[model samples]
Target chain A: MDLVNQILNSFILFKAAFLILNLILIVFLLVVLQQVFAMSSVITDAFDSGIIRTVAIALLVISVSLFLTALVIL
Target chain B: MPDLFIAPLNKQEEPKQSDDLLMSKSSLPLTELPSNLHLFSSFVANPRGIHFQNQDSDEKVLLFIKRDLITNIVWVGISILFIFIPIIIAVASPFMGNFLNFLPGRHIFFYLLLYYLFVGTYVFVNFFTWYFNIALVTNKRIIDVDFSSLVYKNVAATKLSLVQDVSYDQVGIVRSIFDYGDILVQTAGTLDNFHFEAAPSPENAVHIIQDLIGKEARNGLS
Candidate 1:
């Protein structure tokens, strides 16, 4: 019984570590998205298409949502 | 009989300067390019500048250049190695047995994916910043656009007449072999000096600017 409990506790710790890492990754992704938006605005001459900006925003939003949902299920 | 459907082509010589074109101290059209002037190999001249949404109608781009592409080869190689690191470790683990057991379990796959995505984002941001930062020479002005990082950018411009001196430096064997060097333009008055870093064929850039200065001075436009 003690051995089983020890194994379960280690599993819990591993799950917690995964959660913490996911949170950090989320924050970094947000920063990256912000940087992209800032760069596009500051260098307006480079990105000519409104559709490209829209697509970039959409992809970022969908990825963030999906990742969070998967983490919640886990 | 000559084909009646074909219209006669005009053999009349085009005027050196069009009456409709506006003349500014800083703008020069491509048709009026200086004698014996050739842009460095890296540069592509556009009659109207690219990446500019509201560029002046009269502003003609003389030379457009970016840093030598050879400089990015190392970073590209590093990025590729990083992307394949997990696969490499996995393939090697079988030969090494439990010696590689220290590696994270399969449960870490999702986390690893996210980590890789973050790294890929960083690489992409840096590459675009390097690619977009450009040095421009136009009939009327010399421009330097620098994008140092995601958060910071700087653009400096000075009139042709204000270019007091132009010089180039090729200090190392790599630069000499690549034919890529730096062009320094010393401006008069309060304007800051424009430094074209890692410019390809720095000699031509210097000559082009020098020619512009001489022409401007001789025309009494300076």
Candidate 2:
């Protein structure tokens, strides 16, 4: 029973750590997104730049979505 | 009658296109050649619709280069390996026994999802690093745009007038096989040298720059 309790406690601790780490990552991704915008403005292409920005935005969205889902489920 | 009347108008226009027109015509050899580049190209000659800050309105972008596409194979392979981790673990689960129980239960799905998302982001960052790290050869100048680690970027450019020598190095078999190598541009005086690493068809690029230099010298523009 004690072993099971310890395992459960460790698991919760790990989960909390993961959530905090993910929050940091979310913030980092925002910076990456901003850099993409900054770079696009510095040098640009006619047709393909929109796709690059959109992909960066998509990566941010997916990361945020995963963080929120993890927060609720865990 | 219309042809005869229009012929004199054409004759009157001939003097307008004298030495300046001939110089322009001489420079048109490469410019008149069609150079169309797709979205993901590594070596783009005469790419249309590429513009940079501080660029002249009439400046022409001659080449846009990134590291060869083959360079991304390492990250792509690792991402593929990561993507299959769950399947690999599932196959090994019976042999491992109770070890699988160590995973955060009920939240395993969320963990897996998060892990995959991290892999996705890794792929994205790698792609972005490759995609944005580019060297451009324009009629007016050479520009190197460096984007690395998603947090740092540097853009450097030197006018065609400053370019003194352009050369390339293809050392190893891999570069030779891939036909991509580093291009070094020796600039005049104390200006920084420009290096384009793993540029495609480097000889072609050197030739283009040489042509531009020759033109600049001929026109006394440099």
Candidate 3:
């Protein structure tokens, strides 16, 4: 029973690490995507300011939600 | 109708022969001529003859004629694949689900229609954005016309004589077959390098620029 408990603890720690890593990756990707969208707006002449702002907000929300969910699950 | 017209028409025979010789020497197909093709200041042809500025003017830098390949294919390809792929999959899902049940949406046709709407809007926005943002190359200088976002734009140019080297790289089977690739122009300034990615007939572009450079250099020396 003690051995099983130790194994379970290790698995929990692994899951926590994985979750943190995933959250970090998600945050990084979100930042990069934000920059890309900004550059896209600069290069392309027809970027609707309203649409860009909305899409950016949506992306930010999605990233934050993903990070929070991962933290909660971990 | 007028004597002035008749006199000019009679004198036009010499020009026709000369034009034919020039066309043959240039090896350019007659059919592919730009609509506004006209000889501009003993240098490049300004097909439409819209003199935004004279060749002697400092504003000559703004007269760039970029190869059509850059704006037409590279930008178009990115816009299509990036904006259309998801919509295509979403629309086709109903038909796809008939063969397999593990699809995402419940009402496939509805999702498909919504996807089409989104994609159509996306493409429409991208098309005009790309169209106005390009600058073509002229004989004297490179033009950079950028309509950044909806409001702001920066159009600039650099001299072709300042261009030191021109190289092309076509990688992968798709690039080779499609004849679209990168054209790298090394210049004699602080600008790192001008790179046109996935431009068609890269070799021809390079040759044309090189020939222009050579001709300009000879003219300068003379």
Candidate 4:
């Protein structure tokens, strides 16, 4: 019973660490994506601005939402 | 002593195209941009509407093209499969209930949703790469912009006067029906060959380049 309890505690700790790491990674990706979008907009002014902006904003929102979902589920 | 022989050889080697004839005949006018071709969604047929990076004050964009939309069918099919596979698995879950005991119910669904979102993001990024990478033709140069991968991009340009030969090949039934083909531009000396692959109306593109080259020749002669 004591061994099972110790294993359960270890699993919980691992799960929490995994969630935090995943959240950090998602945040990093969000920053990288935003920078990429900005650079693209600057380089290709002839591209459809509306579409680029829309997609960028959508990605940002979805990523934040995913982060929050992770917080809740984890 | 060899002057008489040189004159005849020079005359035979020279093309018979006169500057006056070339100038008198207007080049083919740029046509309306075609549709149902995702690759050429924003192909600038005329010099009036578009601009490019590092464009000179006087240089004009004659044509901008991307690969044929048909080329994307395979990846698009795969994306469709990714979207449907989860639903298919869910539908079959009843039969494999025992098999999936390891996946707790609501949490498994959430995890699957997260996975789909990541895939969706990946697909979005690739779509931008496909849509933005293009081949451009300007009055003075032929330019190829390749978004080869997520982290790498390459742009190559050569002057129209340097282009030695231009040819096109339209193979396969679909390409023939749609009049889309690959335009290959061979440059003089050691420059890399420029390939405008799966370009729509390649014959017209070739004519445009030929007219530009003829104009350049005329300018040089005068």
Best by DockQ: 2
Q: How does residue B143 of candidate 3 score in lDDT? A: 52
TM-score of chain A of 2: 0.86
Instruction: Indicate whether candidate 2 or candidate 4 has the larger TM-score.
Output: 2
Winner of 1 and 2 under DockQ: 2
Error of 4 at A1 (Å): 6.1
lDDT of 3 by residue, B86-157 (tens): 667657968886542432342333334334444443443444345334444565765554553444656555
lDDT of 4 by residue, B45-99 (tens): 6534445667899876667687766777777888899989888987898898756
DockQ of 2: 0.65
**Candidate 3 residue pairs in clash (backbone atoms < 3 Å):** B36-B47, B36-B48, B37-B47, B64-B136, B64-B137, B65-B136, B65-B137, B65-B138, B66-B136, B66-B137
Q: What is the TM-score of chain B alone in each candidate?
A: 0.73, 0.82, 0.52, 0.78
Which of the numbered candidates is closest to the native, going by highest lDDT? 2
TM-score of chain A of each: 0.65, 0.86, 0.59, 0.60
Superposing every Cα of model 3 onto the true structure, what RMSD results? Answer: 13.2
Task: Compose the digit string of candidate 2's lDDT tens values, residues A1-74.
Answer: 99999988988887897788688778877887888888888888887788878988987888788777777777
Q: What is the interface RMSD of each candidate, in Å?
A: 5.7, 1.6, 12.4, 3.8
The per-model lDDT (C-alpha) reads 0.64, 0.79, 0.50, 0.67
TM-score of chain A of 1: 0.65
Give the fraction of true interface contacts kept by model 2: 0.65
